[model samples]
Target: MTATLHTAPVTIPDTTDQRVVRRRLGPGHRIRFSFWFGPALALAIWSIGSATGLIKPAILSAPWDVVVAFQDQWVNHDLLGNIVASLQRSLVGLTLGVVTGAVLAVISGLSRFGESLIDGPIQIKRSVPTLAIIPLFIAWFGIGEEMKVITIALISLVPIYIHTHNGLRGIDGKYAELAETIGINHGEFIRHVVLPGALPGFLLGMRFAVTSSLLGLVVVEHYNAVAGIGYMITLAEQYGQTDVIVVGLVIYGIFGYCADSAVRFTGRRVLAWRQTLEG
Candidate 1:
């Protein structure tokens, strides 16, 4: 009789992400045209409601009326000029805020002395909303471009500081230990590890900061702004032009969407190595 050979059973490790499992499963494959589905549905509903006389222009303008309002602004108002003015203010404020916030984050994150000096004041400021500070800013700088830009900068910086500082501090200690073992210089180790480690937080903060910039712009423009989307909204409110108001709101929505999309796209490119859920 031949001896029978026994084989050991092999165990395969679970590679599935349980967090994803807990959520409702989507199509196993990505939907190429699905991005437009939600917006298209919403527009369809709005148009149907308007046509059926269920939704009135008093509550919400018809899509056609909004288009007409946009054309009116393009033809009559200095719409492009207002947009340019708004962009200049927002971009300038964003540049200043991002640069300052990153520098402060680096300083505070790397040093106990800096953290002790800087962190407390910033934390105090975090409790206050940008809207709450407009009066004080007006008192200090008057209702001018100076006040508006400064307000937007202040609004934008806090998130950047908080997130980037957290990111820098949250870097893996093992990497630092390894760097030390390799006898890498402090600057070189930082260049390779610290900045990269903090990039996710930085990108995340940038998304928020951009939104905050727009928010601050809205508040300031509503107050006494001579130009901007918010100014258009204010004018429309005074005139009871629901369609124009919708146009202003739509412009704002578009700005926010486009800005977020740009940041997300850039972040995906920059952090290509990251295996994120969205990625």
Candidate 2:
């Protein structure tokens, strides 16, 4: 007689969802994919379409034509001057917006009295599109540099206030309790805990603020008497210089992307303890 042994097969329980397992690429890889590969592919397609006459060179200038236009404008026109003017306006408006927003956010976020006094009016103001006030602003400020700068500032203020106030108010109650138990003073608690906790939201607001600021500057420049890139774009439109207009648009796009990237980088560094959840 032979003895036979039977063994049971083991099953492994799955813990992770296979559907959610995405490719994990490094930072450099992501940058290359977005900045290098994406741009190269776009350029290739654009060039091919231009060469094949699929795209009209009149409406959309070839890449080389844009380059030539850029060189010509740089040499003959005040390209750098326009860039500096635009940058200065953006910076000034951004500064005003950030300062005003942060101050108002802190006031409304910290105290019930402040919130009661300030939040209602702000909420009302926010509901109305800032662009809708362009007519009023033009009448009040008269389409001058003041109007342009104020336009940018006003457009930027809403996002910063909304985000920062939300951030400050959204701090964990547990942290407040812990601070109370630890005998941390109000100022110290805000400095060490509340502000740090709210930093992500603040940075988010700044990102929105930067974008709004640029947009406002551009729109404001569309009005009378401007010496920025937007003014140059307006002039290009009048002269049928599509290539120059495209170059200006490209510059605006590049600047906005870079500014957003800078804000994201700063947030990552500042909020080192936080982990980004991939959806």
Candidate 3:
């Protein structure tokens, strides 16, 4: 009777057994969203302001106007040609700058005598703005693509050199000691260790250099250039076609973003181990 009168055991769920799903944003996810969202929001606000006439449409065309202009340029294939020309110059300049910088950085990193020979001259040259040398470039190379490419290369060289040199010198001392203990020759060590370690910085510098190169293209093409995005902008300016100028500006912005993203993607792939370690 007592057992029969006993109450059935309560079916209570354990608090610990309940799932506690975290809704918090992760650092990586947040960073990724912020990177894209910030620009997008700003652009949206700018477009809305222009469209509503709150901002001067003549000075800053509405987003729709730019889009239409872009479509017209695209349909005419004018944008495509300009983009290709600009890309060709940028790639050539970037290649030359990176190669020259890498050579100089390796020399400086590996030999004290080489460092002493080049470092001072590089520092002195770096102090003088490369933009100031555009005239010299024009005089020596003439007002052609060569002058543009050389100017861009010269402008790009300093950042890459500085970063590469710093990266090489910044290598962990332990690794240097280990390489020496393992009978690794300086050349072999540089190939296997120094270059890989310095690559991230080198790539970062290249990104900056490329950006500068794009900006310089405007100046470079400001002269006798007949085709290129910069040339298109110059034409637009001459005609006072704000819409076309805005389209050109948008193209440059997009191109710069793509270039920087390419560099960043390459760096991420090349420095996967470094990223993992940092994470």
Among all candidates shown, the one with the greatest lDDT: 1
For candidate 1, what is the TM-score? 0.88
In candidate 2, what are the lDDT values of residues 125-151, reduced to their tens digit? 889988789999999989888988888
- List ranges where model 2 is wrong by over 4 Å: 1-41, 277-279
Clashing residue pair totals per candidate (backbone < 3 A): 0, 0, 0
Shift in Å, residue 212, candidate 1? 1.0
List model 3 lDDT by residue over 178-222, tens digit each. Answer: 998999997898789988998877987888887887877767878
lDDT-sorted candidate list, best first? 1, 2, 3
Clashing pairs in 3: none
Candidate 1 clashing pairs? none
Q: lDDT scores for all predictions? A: 0.88, 0.85, 0.82
Candidate 1, residues 1-279, lDDT tens digits: the string is 999999999877565664355333643433565556877899999999999999987899999999999999999998888788888888889888989999999999999999999999989999988789889989999998999999989999998999999999999999999999999999998999999999999999999999998888778888788898888989889989999989888887777778877898899799978866665
Regions of candidate 1 where Cα sits further than 4 Å from its true position: 1-30, 33-35
